[model samples]
Target: MWLPQPVHALPERLAQLIWGWALAWWRIVYLGAVVLVLVLSPSSYSRVGRHLLARRMYLDTLPILLGFTALAALLSLIITRIVVVTALSYGLSRYALEMVIRVLVLELIPLTAAMFVAMRCAIPSGAQLAQLRRSGRLVVLERTGADPVRMELLPRVVAAGFASVTLAALSCVVALAMAYFSVFGLGTAGLVSFTRMFGHVFSPEVTLVFVLKTVFFSLAIAVIPMTAGMYDLGASERRSELGGLARMFAVLLLIELVSLVGNYY
Candidate 1:
């Protein structure tokens, strides 16, 4: 019968469809992200918000955020500079800023910052949480009537988020500066037009979208690993490790897809 062949082909076809759909929806997610973050930003909220702020972004998270912010800024400068130089060398300097804007700011920086944190902290945080769960530490705390939210989850979650946002913001600043110098070359001459373009692309709506997207990007990085870690608790160590990485990467990709859709559509 042809049934087995059809069944086998089904998964492949489904995968292709999913992948295509993901690409289509991802832009919308990016466009929607900024607003989400701004609305949920610490300044936007009240005292109750402070607790959420601590949970999402706090001192413990500061170190990683600082490190990532610096890293992202440097990387943005290097990458943008390279693109500009390459363009000018090829006698296509006109395309430099626009290409840099599209590449570094619109797509690469946001995604890159997310991916970096996901790899560095998200995976490790998952492993740590999963190990705690496997060791029954989470349960034991419960026996003693302890709060996992404060002792364990909060710190890591906060760190993951702050790091994500810090890196993202830093990268954006660097990208803007790199674009400036690359285009205007040590002058304030392109200030008006460049600023206009910046304003054009970063409309209040776009900014709102980007804020939402970045925050969610942070959330995904933090939450997915934590979720996986929760499941891995009380499981085999190897299984927990594998599960953490798998879940973190999966969540990162899902976030990326969501942002993409929100941006374009």
Candidate 2:
């Protein structure tokens, strides 16, 4: 049976897609194992190591995160105003709060926070880690039983995750306030209605899902670049370090798409 060339290539394409997904899953599994080990090992939390590394990571990343948060606030305010105005025009004012909560807080803020950390913090840290590995410093540390993964990687991951959560929380708060002001102005006139609407929008289930999604986003931003960088540690060919970053963003987009489907559908 003769078939069109495109149709004949369909199965091969499907196979390639499936294979790519399988490799991604494998990488995810490997990352999960690394996280599990970090969690289960008490020494991964050595107070001095963790504290010093965490302080360095947070201090180094804070300025960037704050700058990103400011930009996010501007964009969020615009979006909130638009949503509020559009809803009022359509006689859907009652749904405005819920729409803002679900769209901005549940969806936009977390993803933005993750990408901000990934670009501004994680990629550079990964490149540094890769460079250290290439220079044989990591091997020396490992030989001395210094457990660089615990003393080094875990703290950065924890700090990056903390930064992501902090940024997301801050952005969400800013957006919520902006949404209220957009809808009801700065006066106390709408306080009661605003509180009621906020409570209704952030029901237990909605709150839980938002928290879970934020945690997943934070962890993804922290872990993906580190793992990707480590995976390519020994490659003979020196490609651009941004290759890991490109892969990290691809994974992030997939995560965001899944979150959207789960939230809306």
Candidate 3:
């Protein structure tokens, strides 16, 4: 007995999908490796190169840092208040600080920072790179003896990664301060207990996981959108943007899940 045509087509479609996904991941890894080499190489830091990197870093980081910190502070204040009030109502006030630290500082702030940078910097940079590629400017630069990847793309990636990490770090501090104030209300009476609780929550293993997760989040925000944009240059602008964002978010979600499992499970 012969199988239906639809059944055969389904397997072919599945294989195609798997192949495409694997190829996309391979390209992202390849690009990331190339960028890493360029970043570490001494020759990539000529005077002009240093200037480009510095300028991109400034553009990526300073302008948005204040706004992001304020947003993080507001969210931290609201969440800490809710957690403290709820914990007090349940007579579980002892756990409120721990919960606040774990939820806001460990999980939410890094993810938020990554997304914010992706939107503000990564996605647009990727789109610009894609346009340059599509318009053959990259080839023109290559013919002129300029390494387009080194001179154009590398700084953007580095700046974006730095921005994500910086934003997360700053926001984490803000969140912790907010958590303290919300729980203790402008007094030093809780200082010792707060430090003890903070230390307890950030054990070596947990601390390692948190650091790794934030780093991975920064990497994803830095790399994924650019990879998607560069490789999907044939697609329409809106579609490319959406696709890049979708892939970035998917990687971020996977990273978050892994971190959650490592931290809690």
Candidate 4:
């Protein structure tokens, strides 16, 4: 007797799922190799590469990163005030500094910075790269003996990584200052106490985790969209662009979830 349709399809579906995961893993490995080659090649630091890097840094990264960092600072100031006021109202005023440090510096600021770069920079850059690839421009450049990965992709990824770290660091400083001011006002009276609290909260272990989390956030913001753009199954530029963004954001969220689990649990 012939099997039922559902049973007949089950093996095929399982095979398809397994194949998809294999392809995904292969893409990740290829992306990692591309990044490693770009970073390790001495030719990547040539004058032309330096010019490209500067252009990406000044034109593409700095302006938007600064504007977003400022916006994050304002939002952080508001949040700091709220946290401080709530802690005071709850008779948990002693924990206010620690709460601000944990929430703002250790978590929110880096995530916000990564998301900002992803939305404003990474997706658009990936879309443009996909469009160029769809138009065969990258292949044309390759035919000229120029590595498009080095010439075209490296600067953008490097700039994005730098922007992520810069924005996160600056926003953390702003948030810390705001937290201090919000809790203790402008007087010098609480300076010693604030220093003590900051030191206590940023023990070596917590500091190490914060550094690693920021590094991972920057790498994710820089690398994921480019990888998706290069590897997604879509042929059309429009479809590739959308697919890249979807995959990039999904990866970012997964990284964030992992960070949360590691930090809290």
Candidate 5:
């Protein structure tokens, strides 16, 4: 069913705005679907939607992940050079690296990356989706005897999730390498301690929890945007954006709280 997707008056600024939204939608669906499968298996029929989502994600998310990783690496390095180094110069260097890694790399970096990615790409995606539905695209599909839910939206949700997870993993790898150089200055002396510290910080259970937390963060990022987009299909457009983000962020915070609790537990 092809719904009436009208051609709007696309002004340059609004067009740019719409483009951002479009990018967000694709990433949110692509990335979100992959991560969701990792979380739980839906019904067999959902697999087709997942494949579509995965395909979109494969085409779109990989390049974004690489770009984001590069950008994040640069940001982490700048922070380390200034904040971490300054602390060290003040004779507080002994505690600098671990603290930096904990705050900037492990905890803060991942959250920041997810949120930034969501806002940068997912929010716009959500809005466009809402507009698509409003334009009667969903109804059009129904008339054509097609499933709008699985065929149209599910793939998008999956893509958003996939983008988030892939980007996070890429950023983490960059952070790990940067952490070593930030502390040890490209020397081998820090590898032993770094490995030990890493091992201590991320044990079996801890590692599991960490992975879970990231997945939630990724899911929230995707789910919120998609929810917002879909909700708009049924509500007033003026205030319907980011419906999923609100719920997603709340859950993301809860997951963080849980992670902290378990870590200190």
Candidate 6:
């Protein structure tokens, strides 16, 4: 039986979509491997390399750190107050601190920090890299015997990773403090109970999961956009940006889901 043309083309379209997706992921993995190798190679960090890394790190980290910290503090204050009030109203005051810590420090802060870095630094850096590649600047550097990956991409990747981790850590501290003040006021009356609850919430297994999740989030934020930008797939610049952002969000969501299962299930 002869099928309609549209029906016959359906499978082809699906296959093409699958292939494109696989190719994009493969590029990400390959680029990540190259970056890891460069990072581990001491020869990649000569005096000039160190200067590039330091300058890029400063550019990536300092502009956003204070603003992000302030925003995290405000968000922590609001969330802590709400959780404490709700828990108190429900006669679940004892669980309030635990919930706040798990929800904010262990989960939300890291994800928020990753997203913030992605928006503030990673995506823009990727876009700039794409522009440079498109304009043949990367090729020019390559022709000059320069390792563009070492001089250009590595700094951005390392800086984004550091910024994400630093932001998450600082935000988590702010959140913990805000939660304590929200529940305990301006006194040390609840200090003993708070310490006990904090310890209970951050058991070894939970702490391990938290750390791993934050690291994965930072890695995704650091790597995905650059991969998309560096390896163009016959897409327009706008399309590339949108596609990279979507992929990055999907990976972040997957990491969050895995962490949630590890923690709760």
Using lDDT, rank the candidates from best to worst. Answer: 3, 6, 4, 2, 5, 1
lDDT of 6 at 164: 97
What candidate 3 gets wrong by more than 4 Å, as runs, is 1-12, 232-241
Worst 10-residue lDDT window for candidate 2 reads 233-242
Q: How do the residues 1-265 of candidate 5 rate in per-residue lDDT, one tens digit apiece?
A: 9875445644666887787567555655664565456446465246666677678677547657777888888877887778677886799876676666666666776787678668766666767777878788888988898767666666666667777777877787798788779767878988998888777767788778778878778777766676655644344345445434555676778888898787668
| Model 3, global lDDT | 0.90
Report model 6's TM-score to 2 decimal places: 0.94
**lDDT (C-alpha) at residue 133 in model 4:** 79
Please give the CA lDDT of all the candidate structures: 0.68, 0.75, 0.90, 0.79, 0.70, 0.90
Prediction 5 TM-score vs. true = 0.74
Tens-place lDDT per residue, model 6, 1-265, is 9956788799999998898778778888898899889989999789999999999989999999999999999998999889889999999988988999999999899999999999999999998888888888889999999988887899999999989999999989988888888888989999999999999999999999999999989889999999866865565557767877899999999999999999999
Badly placed stretches (over 4 Å) of model 1 are: 1-60, 89-92, 232-237, 240-244, 261-265
In terms of lDDT, model 2 sits at 0.75
Write candidate 3's Cα lDDT for 1-265 as tens digits: 9956777698899997798668767877998898889889999899999999999999999999999999999999999999999999999999998999999999999999999999999989998888888888888999999998887889999999999999999999999999999888899999999999999999999999999999999889998888865664353556656766787889999999999999999
Q: Which residue pairs does candidate 3 place in steric collision?
A: none
lDDT of 1 by residue, 154-244 (tens): 5576677778877888778876886788668888889998887777777676677678878877877766566556553343546545644
Cα displacement (Å) at residue 33, model 6: 1.1
Q: Compared with the true structure, what per-residue lDDT tens digits does model 4 show for residues 1-265? A: 9956788799999998788667765765687678778778898999999999889867667778668867877887888788878988999988978888888888888898988987788767776777777788889999999988888788888888888888889889888887878777999899999999899988887788788888888887787777656653764545545545666678767877877787778
Candidate 3 local lDDT, residue 144? 98
